[model samples]
Target: MDKTAIKKFAVEARRSLIESIRLKAATLGITADGIQAKLPISTGDVEYYVDEQGGISGHDIVKRQKLVAELKQRARKNDLATAFNDLIEEVAYTWFNRIIAIRFMEVNDYLPSRVRVLSSTENRNIPDILVNVRDVEEALGGFTASEKAIITRAEDTELPKDRDAEYQMLFIKQANALNKNLPYLFETTNDYAELLFTPSYHDGVIQHLITDISEDDFNVAVGGQVEIIGWLYQYYNTEPKNTVISMPKSHKFRDTEIASATQIFTPDWIVKYMVQNSLGKYWIKHLLAVGSLQNESEIAREFNWQYYMPDAKQPDNVQSKIETMDSSLKELEIKQLKMIDPSMGSGHILIYAFDVLMQIYESEGYSRREASESIIKHNLNGLDIDTRAFQLSYFAVMMKARQYNRRALTKITHMNVYDIPGTDDFKLEDFEILLSQLSENSSRLLRHFLQEFTFGNELGSLILEYSSSLTSLREELDALNHNQLSFELIPLLDKVADILNSVELLGQKYQVVITNPPYMGSSRMESHLLKFAKKNYPNSKADLFAMFIERWNKALVSGGYNAMVTMQSWMFLSSFEKMRVNLLGNYTISNLMHMENNVMGIAFGTAVTIVRDYQLPSFIGTYHQIKTADVSGKIPQHLPIADNRFNRTNQANFAKIPG
Candidate 1:
């Protein structure tokens, strides 16, 4: 909850983790230049390299080959420098994520072992899991077969032991054990860590993480929130953001750096305001449509919402237009209502929306556990370009679900959160060859669908133009699943099936589409992204945020709410004139709060705007123009004072004013 402290720890953590991981990589004889040393761990026919800590058997030798292949392939993809640094940063951040997750689990007593993995309950410095591994009975978490073998070796008296090496091996075993539960954070054969998890790192980086941050920061009983991970993620990107800015003007943000350059954490208050007005307002409208709730103020009070503005008295025409709202809300079940944050960086917006959805579900007679599962399974969806962001968001949501349901994590088979897939590595030629075997129009649709996924790392959720084709591909793939196929094609189709599910979610309609979309002007866009926006979104091609404003609108139904926190320049800049005209012509704003510069560490002025997907040209919308600069902790305090300065106007009125 302490932003200053979280930021300080995160910025420093990034530097320390990167340096530590790099040092560990160096010890392993892998460097940006090339692999300088190889310990031949021969397994019959294949030549394999031994790791730094050595003494690993056949499985590790095979995994080490995987790691080497990935590194060499990446170096071929870009330069050696880019690939090396990216691999190091990725591994470092992943470990950072794992440490944070373990601490949270330990504090919450959510670990199945009922043991603290990172720090001892009796002593802050000692890892209880490490100590626990010394005794076979202390391994209450239940280790895998390989891990038990390692444990048996650790207990061997004749084996000469280095305590540091012992601890390193034990911690890796614990990480591997946790992998079955948390595959998202730690894949069983984690390519990044397979070759890099060295004895040097445990002696250096792991201790630094445990000792550096305050214990209370990870303890929920002491006022910590799982949302601290979001702050840490934002802070971690500070250096990358600065690096992007320091680049030459013509330099474009490549795939690896795009997320880092554009992710800005939405302040909680702003997120609440956006969600309260969009999804919150949608539920109220549903209640009104079905005559379940009439008085908006009474509903707001019942919900205990600080930012939900009860609608003001409307003119007769505006009131009549409102009366024509979708009464079909009464026909649909609450679970049918879907909401997504397409640019869900660390899922800050979706996290708040989860709480709101929980209240809505419980009000309708669902238990907390049932409602939590339903929210994750049915109501909430998220998408992001950054895999790291996706993982953090996934962890945050899963942790939140675990807060309500004891068995939520294990029971979850799939979540709607997806990092948009890129087509660069896609085996399209093979899929196409399989498709040539008497497929329906699926082959054509599959081609179009895969084509749309191109540049996904750069364009991300903005790749909405092919949603129709993606849906068709889904149907065809579903049909194909029932039929017998070639063994090779079956595996290939299985991969496509997974991607199909995610892309279909990306393209589907939602009742509420909310996000603080990535903000970068057209001038800064990489050539591929710039070209895509120009071709697909010419009207709103001025900035990435503006393009998202247009894109998410397509992701919503007619009566859905499209809400976002974004740079305020879209409201006035000449470059955005066409975009404004398009919005005014198609949608009606319900609420707009224009804030002064540096509102959320953004230098430019910004606004939180909520617009109805339907057109109500005559409807007067609430607009709060707050000039207070950097209202960091003071937003809620300023709202009441801001009310007197607010204006009610039809957004169409903006068209009459000069650009």
Candidate 2:
């Protein structure tokens, strides 16, 4: 469409969308005089129309302008919901590229192809083709010219003989949608068409789609997507099909099973609260002290959040997730606060850290770019036994930094986390290859051999699994691939073992450590991890998180804090007396947040204990004891729970003794 045609259509579409918005708002008793919406008048209720082919018709542009006007008016009136929706529609429609539109549809089940585009109107226009579902049509609407050509060619052919005509028809419909919509957008459509029209293409695309979706849902965060993108390029992988396209690794699709399990996503509201409470005045104070800012009042005005906030839908949430730990910290003067999550599953903490730093930048006057650079350079770090998790953790950390500066995202690179100094390292690429090979073709003889080598040897099991690829290995079995694999299968397994050991030595220094270490009861502990732990702490008994705590105390500087979330059993269990004694003798218990009676909805009781290396002024002791009257009126002795975050003052007959 010419610019004028596009502009005019944009206007009409915008007006129609606005009318729909108005009508909806009226239902909510929000419209002026509670009248039904009419055309030619602008209200905050603007709608967006994306064509069946997914492009904004000329009508959409006009509606967008009107929507903007309505939003400004609404903002003046302080009608926040109306104003916010108006602004969202305006922004989504204005910058709504086909890629992002496709992405939105890909994730949200509610977004129909003809539904008011991207949080615009809730209602939709009925399409001429009720034949295909509106969702499919919407998904197909964004196809390119090459995609269209592929469809035309497919229509002319006697193909997909193994599949039913209805299946073929759906495929053709999808192809046509691509063709109609994706004029200039889809790259390498010709190559993909060749794959899709062929049986190999059908098989390849299906398998690839299943593989990506499954792997992604398992744990692929934004960084995992980056790695996948890089791998696709490195391996010359193709799109699934000409019509049924796969989301790029950069686009996350939680696996079906995992997605259905529970909402693992940290609630944005909860995240906001955490960021607000944790960072608080520390950010403001640090910003002034560092001279990053003269005061806190300049925060929202100077930072230009649009640059830092990637998803416009949740600016406040994003901001909350990443404000500074302490604004009082200066870029030049702030002491480095190193952290390590030994288990480091999917880098949640690291991602949170990024948000914290961004807020710090906001607290100061630093632009998003300046603040991001400083944080990545100085404040963040992570570790994991699983290489995939390690790569993912790194990816998350870098992505967090990149959110502040896209250019930096490009420069972020991946290196094997196990690569340590003065060691002939094992390459992850080699291990990944072994896994792929195992997936492609593995003999029963090989399986039997691996089971023997891996069973009771968790690391070996992990190697066997990784050797099997994401598709072949069961989810629970995937954890075994971290360290132990059959030595015969990957002759360099021993070398990799050496590298892991060296990494442990080299990575002994860190200031703060936090993690949700995997749980293993004494009976259930995998043989390898159990053996390793026993050898390391010959006389002590503890859980995985406690072992890590001991390691962290050894690693930290005198004043550093080790904050942890761990099971409550560690507090009073007689088995952990030795471990407790060692901890109390070596570290000062600073603060504790205990969730008694399972207050946090955590199935297992847990607490956050802050232990510092410096000694406490009082010998509040090696062990804390308390006495309480039971409901039966019997007196019972009470002791400090595992890490002593609980206050002993409230409980009567309590004692604190030195180790």
On lDDT, the leading prediction is 1
Q: What is the TM-score of each candidate against the true structure?
A: 0.90, 0.43
Instruction: Give the residue spans of candidate 2 off by over 4 A.
Output: 1-332, 362-365, 387-395, 414-508, 597-600, 617-659
The 10 consecutive residues of candidate 1 with the worst lDDT sum are 47-56
lDDT of 2 by residue, 261-293 (tens): 111122222222232322322344445556666
| Model 1 agreement with the true structure over 1-659: per-residue lDDT tens digits | 55676677777877887887787666555678787545566446444233535343456555556666667756765778778888888887777777677777887887767777667788745567656664533333555676566656656642435444556665565566666666676555345575565533234545555666667776767787777778889988888889987888788888877788888988778888889889999998888888988777677778877788766677898787777767667776789999999989898887889889988998899998889889988999998888899888888888888877888867865678877767654556766765775357777766766677667768888877444655555556666644577655765675566557667777688999999998888888878888898999998898899999998887888789999989899998888898888888888889988988876666778898898887878778889876654365454542642346678786668768987
Candidate 1, clashing residue pairs?
Answer: none
Give lDDT: candidate 1, residue 20: 70
Error of 1 at 225 (Å): 1.0
